[model samples]
Target: MRAVILAGGQGTRLKPYTAVLPKPLMPVGDMPIVEILIRQLQSNGVDRITFALGHLAHLVQAVLGNGKRYGVEIDYSIEDKRLGTSGPLSLIRDLNETFLVLNGDVLTDLDFLDITRFHADQKSTITIACHKRSVNIDYGVIHRDGFRVTEYEEKPVIELYVSMGVYVFEPAVLSYVDPETYLDFPDLVNRLIHKNEQVKIYPYDGIWFDLGRFEDFNRVHEIWDDLKPKILSHE
Candidate 1:
């Protein structure tokens, strides 16, 4: 199977580090973030990958270099300009079959093979990998019914399901994405939903982290040695 990684983001949230290096090239353990993702995909039976690159594209290419060292065939789709998330996929003409798409900065133990199979079984045009998250309100939130004041819940935590930036998309879904336009994944999903297209979501309850911020980067560094063995066992 082929996987397309969105590795071109400017990663503004990660300042000094990203100033010198692309977010995907930032070190997590002993390897760069994109390298870890490539290794994980290799372990999961995916050996062909296309990296959608923009900011500091050459540096990423130089570091990864055809992916032969990692047991994968690596190619790149250089974006002349920033093409949000889904927009980059439109540039990859070879993805006529179902393929996996993910953000390079995400660290997860999700089973890619399982997600691919699930997408096929469900016959969904797009399958999003979702995770449940909770947000707590700092103050009491009042629920009002008409003019009467209803019950007030103090510091209630709301549970919400969100995309983990991992997706399985059939080629048919490409019709929904506009070529040469900047579009985010969420907007594409919304368009699919509005058109009554089958857009399924597979929930994952596993080890996952988005190393987009300084705190997350530091957190991964702290747990690198402990998590490396389990996540990179095949390497």
Candidate 2:
């Protein structure tokens, strides 16, 4: 199977670390973030992979070099300019069959094979890997009825489902991606929904992290010793 990784982002959120290297090249555990994702994809039977890169593209190519050491053929699609999330896929002409695409900064233990199969079974044009997240408001949220006093909920944690930055897409979905413009994944999803196309979500209740901030980066380092055994076992 073929997989494409969106490694082109400037990762402004990651700041100093990204100032020197691409987000994908930032070390996570013992390997670079992109390397970890590559190993996971290989272990799950993805034989060929493509990197869609913009910032520090050469650095990524230099480090991952043909993906031979990792047992997968590595290819690249360089973006001369920034292509928001899903726009880079429009530049990869070889993607004819169903393929997997993901953000390079994510750290997850999701089973890629299972996601692919689920997409096939559902006959969905696009499938997103989703995670359930909760956030609590600092102040009380009041339900108002104009001039009437209503009940209020204080500091309640609200549960919401959000994209985990991973996706499986059939070739047909490419039609929605414009070749010359920057387009985000959510925009494509919205268009798909408007067109009544089948879009599926695979909820993952597993270990996952979006290493896009300094706090999360530090947290991963703190827990690396404990998580290494399990992560290495999978590799």
The Cα RMSD of model 1 versus the native structure comes to: 1.1
Q: Indicate the TM-score of model 1.
A: 0.96
Give the range where candidate 1 is weakest over 10 consecutive residues by summed lDDT.
226-235
lDDT of each: 0.89, 0.90
Q: Which stretches of candidate 1 lie over 4 Å from their true place?
A: none
Q: Please, what are the lDDT tens digits per residue for candidate 1 over residues 1-48?
A: 999999888989998778889999998877889888998999889989
The segments of candidate 2 whose C-alpha lies over 4 angstroms from its true place after superposition are 146-150
The local lDDT score (0 to 100) that residue 202 gets in candidate 2 is 98
How many backbone clashes does every candidate have? 0, 0
TM-scores of the candidates in the order shown: 0.96, 0.95
Question: How many Å off is the CA of 80 in candidate 1?
Answer: 1.4
